[model samples]
Target: MKKQHSRPNILVVNDDGITAPGIKNLIEAVKELGNVVVVAPDGPQSGMGHAITIGKPMRFNKVDLYEGVEMYKCSGTPVDCVKLAVNKIFKGKKPDLCVSGINHGLNNSINVIYSGTMSAAVEGAIEGIPSIGFSLDDYAEEADFSHCLKYVKSIAQQVLDNGLPQATLLNVNFPKGNGIKGIKICRQANAKWAEEFDERQDPYGRPYYWLTGVFQNNDKGEDTDVWALDHGYVSVVPVQFDLTAHHAIPLLNSWTFND
Candidate 1:
């Protein structure tokens, strides 16, 4: 018997399409948690970042994939999907929390800048809802997320139970396979991608370049997300939307541009 007076309605989403195995597994895992409503893209939108459809018309339709779960597929970016859900779809009802992704690849280090997974969660944060983004460091379509579900549910429940700081959300990454030991709450690591372009000739004889890179982690701190991930644990990074360099404000006031 399920006890339910209102178990906190949870709005689940992801950058991956509705049918992705990652989300399929996620929905099953969260069924015991609360009312799960999924609003996601109709297809993969991996590197879409935080983009939204403004100049173009967006479309969303109810989906029948998950039997008792409310699911919808949108024709816009991940951010657009959240906007539609909050403004139009679930208008009068507010979700207790929003969780994005069991993404195909890692969103650690600097990859969050280009992650559609994090963007959806960030959009929820912007709307004053507690949110979280979860990703695994594997890119295969059938990647094993067996090692991630327990940690995902634990983190989600923690966020739901304790709540989060206003204007902040979590960006979580799990190591691939079953070797993961546990979870670690850490800060974002200072790292970047060292790019390399591979030039190739297209079928029409036109030259193009494929962008590739080696991830360079310059931070050696044990408390960083990168360090935690490398140590075989799920890294929970508290992410905030405030990009202001507050410490630099005082230094900027002392600058002399007239000289």
Candidate 2:
């Protein structure tokens, strides 16, 4: 049997409210690995990337959902839940690992920038904690996660034993249902959205618009997350917070600013 502190203390979070089945499944998987805590949004917060509730007061309440796990529901963005967990809830205690998601949909390729699931994991990395985000390609409320729990536990166990690199975390995505064959460490694919807006009218006849898009992937690389998912493998991409274009710095230095 592993001793108390010998096993990691884990903080679990997600964008899809505390009540979502995705988080519930995640909580069960992590419990077998270590002590777990959950702090998540009170309602669905999809697409709220890295957003904090600075403009308004944030609130959270404890709930008894998962047995043997301490859980809280917060009225803030996914990032805010991490902030609250580290700063207020845990205070001086820092968790060994932070895991987000088992999100209802895919967060691969360019979707990371707009993903609240990834944002929660990003927040943990910002606070100097080892973090990881997990998502499934399925978007339905009843999406099957039976195939993901084994991989989730294995990956979480490995991260707990061997910590992640500084300033970097993992972005993991799984294909929906029981089709997953194995895990693949992959790079982020070059992809973007072919956007469209659906115009519609309300009961009052005022027009409103709903944003939609199809993904366009130009890169044909087989070592990318996109390719891995398409091949029925779970994709794990190591992500960094620094967005500096190191290659472009030299080009800017050659420009003459003196007029």
Please report the candidate that would top lDDT against the real structure. 2
Q: How much does candidate 1 score in TM-score?
A: 0.94
Q: Could you report the Cα RMSD, in angstroms, for every candidate shown?
A: 2.9, 2.2
Give the CA lDDT, 0 to 100, for residue 67 in model 1.
80
lDDT of 2 by residue, 202-240 (tens): 999999999999999998999999999999999999999
Q: List the lowest-lDDT window of 10 residues for candidate 2.
A: 1-10
Candidate 1 — what's its lDDT?
0.88
Q: Which stretches of candidate 2 lie over 4 Å from their true place?
A: 1-5
For candidate 1, write residues 1-259 as lDDT tens digits: 1223469788888898888887887777676788888999999988899999989898799989868989999999999988888987779577888988889899997888889999999999999888999998989998988888888888888887878988999999998788788889999999999999999999999999999999999899999999999899899999988889999999999988976
Provide the overall lDDT of each model, using Cα atoms, as 2-decimal numbers. Answer: 0.88, 0.92
